[model samples]
Target chain A: MTNSEIMTIHQALFIVMALAVLGSAIFVVTTSNLFRAALMLILTFFGIAGLFVLLDIGLFAVAQVLIYIGAISILIIFAVMLTRGMQGMVPRNSQAVAAAVTAGIIFAVLLLLFGPFRVTVDVARWPVFSLFAGNASPRDVGGIAWTPPNQPIPAMPETYIADFGRSLVDGNQYLLPFLLIAFLVDVVLAGAIFIARQRRPAEIIEDRRRQAEEAAEEAEAMRQAGMTPDVAPLPEGAVASTAEH
Target chain B: MDLINDLLKIIGDFIAGIINSIFGFSPFLADLVTMGLAAVMLCTFAALSFMGLTYVERKVVARIQDRVGPNQAGPFGLLQPIADGIKMFTKEDTTPATADRWVYNLAPLVIAVFALTTYAVLPFAPGVVGTNLNVGVFYIIAMGSGSIVAIIMAGWGSNNKYALLGAFRTVAQLVGYEVPMLLNVLPVVMITGSLSLVDIINQQTTLNGNPGIPFIVFFPFSALVFLISGIAETGRSPFDLLEAESEIVAGFHVEYSGMKFALFFLGEYVNALAVAFVFSTLFLGGYAGPVLPPYIWLMLKAAVVFFIFMWLRGTLPRVRVDQMHNLNWKFFVPVSIVHLVVVMALMKLFVTSPALAQANGGVLVTPGAQAAILFVASLLILIGSLAVVARRARILRLQEAAVLEQRRAENIAAVSA
Candidate 1:
């Protein structure tokens, strides 16, 4: 099929992304397991990324996929897994209710805001350049290319498309917002660090003590066993120690 | 109004005209040409710059340390980058047995793409952008954010704790710094009233004759904020906590070897250049100089910032992560916000004033009562919110003190018993 035809065909399947988001959201709320919830939330982020692509903000789409899906999602999943006593995390009813209410509000707001905005751009009207043909294809030729009599045309920008590097970082319209965001992020970082520190000081102290003790034990063991103290195999010996425990 | 409508009509017609020109004969052919050109440009720039940047960074760093860098390879180590490239090519490509092969391979490609892709909307010279796409700055911000994800993928895909730790530090640092970096630019946007980089540069040139009041020079506080935040954004010293060699063992790319490692290195330098270039342009009267061509001036500006980055690498000690966040939150963010307000006020008082506006080659910013009123109201709102929070905190503190006193008495009685 020609590029236009493919985009047209894929247009309908775009709803699949929406469905995935819905499914993931449900999973996030309903799943009792914390890890499962985090995983589902990651899927939900992916779905949102897909929606960003559909919205014509390809940069935002990539970012959503990369940041929310790739980095933030992983960090969250790590945090969830790292949380002590995370097993048997029952899905809370209040969380479910909050999620439901939030979703309803978002849907209602979207419907109310965008329902009347008539979008005139049609699937057929979108500029879809066929690549296989050595020349620009006419409408008739495009039709032939999509359901070719024999030879297929090359792909268009839309088909194997990636909009790279369209954003400028120095525009006046963005300068203040950029600075503000930097400042805001700084605040968040400080707050996160402070909270993390405050909550985990005991854990931090314990962790350090354990590590120091382990190191000392390894050194003493190495000396006692007549192994070179300089080449202390603490990392290797830790595995054996854990096995013994 | 008629002129604007006519201009808009003409622009629409021009686009329609171009579409018509390429509409017939088989659109596939046109696609091939466009895509082919894009690919060629992308590869050529990325490949050439990657090599050049590697050599430049090493030599520059070496010089900063009062040592000869790569002089053995052809004329002041001009061919060193080439030698390094060849070395990478000849090295035995190895992947860890425990690594996720697909992700491990994909990590470098994603990093390189994210780095190179940032150049798309950057204007090297007037009317010489890759594509003057709308919302260009926003796109860069978004793409830059994507790079963090790629870093995480690299870290995770490597299956090494050091790499994971590095990636975690990086993600936290980048995400954390991005806010102030963005905040510092808001005043510029407010003043210029356009998102286009070209428009901003053009605006700068228009202020050529003005003394000590170049758009960027005028907003000294914002400029400093942008530069500092830009340095942090690019993960340069003293903010290079993520990839501290002694700390996280080269951070996320610890497991990557051979060409993959090379790609990460290349991505980093290019990313630095990109940030420096953008930062220079945004806050330093980009490409604005006398006794040089405009493009030359642009290059000079970028080079100056690049030098500063290198100098920073040599001179400044890397800040601890806690200090980095503290600097960002307690100082940078609030100060930047206040700076923005001060600038906005200055703009209102000077640029908006009919008398002084014309003096600095600026269009008179007509003082609107609505804008002034809104500004005042927002300021008041912010103050009110702070007051409420402070009161609540005070009450909580008092309650805590009372509880502590009661506990002290109970403890004394227990001791006596």
Candidate 2:
């Protein structure tokens, strides 16, 4: 960090990206427009990816972009659009203070846990993460040797991704959580399809007939009121425009 | 090996010398100037190539459709792209009355920036690249994916139904095809055991002085899937559901005009070029050929791949939206996943050890034998998947026929009554 210049390039980039991430995060929540919020969420994701790049972990940086910005944000935008009555003015609520306080608390917790300040409160416990071991010796995590506390963290090996990949399918290491996540995704997809399942032909016919009767009744009411009874369902196969603008 | 022989390296060193010695600047200042110069060079290269690519595409597509393309411009349309650029630059830039101003203005720039960022990790030749990030391939994919956000922004900002619909299809197309695209890339990464493009290229043949088999010979199916998915990713024909001119009327960019619209065009061609370069690097042994400079070889390879892209665009008709989704989900995604898994498993089994592979010599089987085995494996998987696809088609045809027959019977009965 020490340099004759005002700041090192890495420090400058880190500050810029951190500000971007934080600013976009606040904008995402504070903005009333759901679409704009989704876009801002993408910027937040991108800035976090920038932070990961600054940390020189290209894998996490790309993963952040690939998964969060690529997939999740798109999904969020889709949800925002598909739900009716959302694109209009969203009423402002009185929860800004609560949200800010909660966010600050989470940020503080994250900083204490794994921030770049390098002052992790539970650094020793994080490797094997055992409370019952009585601090005798640190157990290695996935066969990776643990660095003792109060020394600089060693540079990660080049093949860390390969090691991580191997552990995902290994007999012991992340196989359980990985499988659980896969199963959860499977269930979620199935649940989504079930929720959006089409109605049966009989149900559709009954609904159409009921709508026709309702329209006829409305027409009669309009006629009794001495106005033209022009209100009726449009022809089938017509699209109802739901454009936001 | 020396700067004198490597033209790019020499030019780079010259820039550094001028910045450091001639200017007597601090190291940091010199570095900054060097970076600025490099960025300028890369941008100039990108802009020129983009112009050239647009001209080439029109000419090729025009010839494909039996038309003389752009002959009215300078020297058989050599300067047509420049003319087109001027036209685009001068075109009236109009904003929708109710459009989201900032998002509308920024989307094109963002997409263009994202597209340009992909070149940073691409290796043009040995020791000649923007940055050569360790996770180069992944980084490129991530950068390319950022365009989805720009596209979404364009759609939402336009305040037009067509634009919004285009954005919707973008999500369906890009997100769906990305699975197969990543899976297609997995075989190359698994074979090389590296995400770095240079490493992948070196793994193909050019590692050390020995010439080896290009990965395409080993994973031809992966190459095919990658090209198809790459085209889908680029929003080109047969998978261009995002635009679907007949339906969405130019899709997300319907409202864009002038240079802003041209930026989207730039993003597209740049993306297509990136995909081609990536394909050549992944499969065609980038910069690894006999009797040519490495970057020239890489360019030739990329040009061939790019021509294939143009050829496919000329030959194929846009698929129906349902067909696009079906092709991605029911066919490409599952097939690519299986292909990746099989390749990974077989490669793992055949290669003796990572330590041996790393040593660059020891292996249970020679590279030739491994390539043969991989080729056979890929052929088997390809054939099996195609057969399954055929069976599915037959079943769907029968089901469709049954429905048509039932409808006909109902109609006949009603008429008789």
Best by DockQ: 2
lDDT of each: 0.67, 0.82
Tell me the deviation in Å of residue A129 in model 2: 16
**Which stretches of model 1 miss by more than 4 angstroms?**
A1-245, B1-28, B207-214, B288-291, B352-417
Q: Which DockQ-derived CAPRI band holds candidate 2?
A: acceptable
Q: Write the per-residue lDDT of candidate 1 for residues A138-239, one digit (tens) a residue.
A: 222222222324544443344122223222244644556777898999999889867655434565456556776888888888889988677554464464
DockQ of each: 0.11, 0.40
| Highest TM-score model number | 2
Candidate 1 lDDT for residue B235: 77
Clashing pairs in 2: none
Deviation of model 2 at B144, angstroms: 1.4
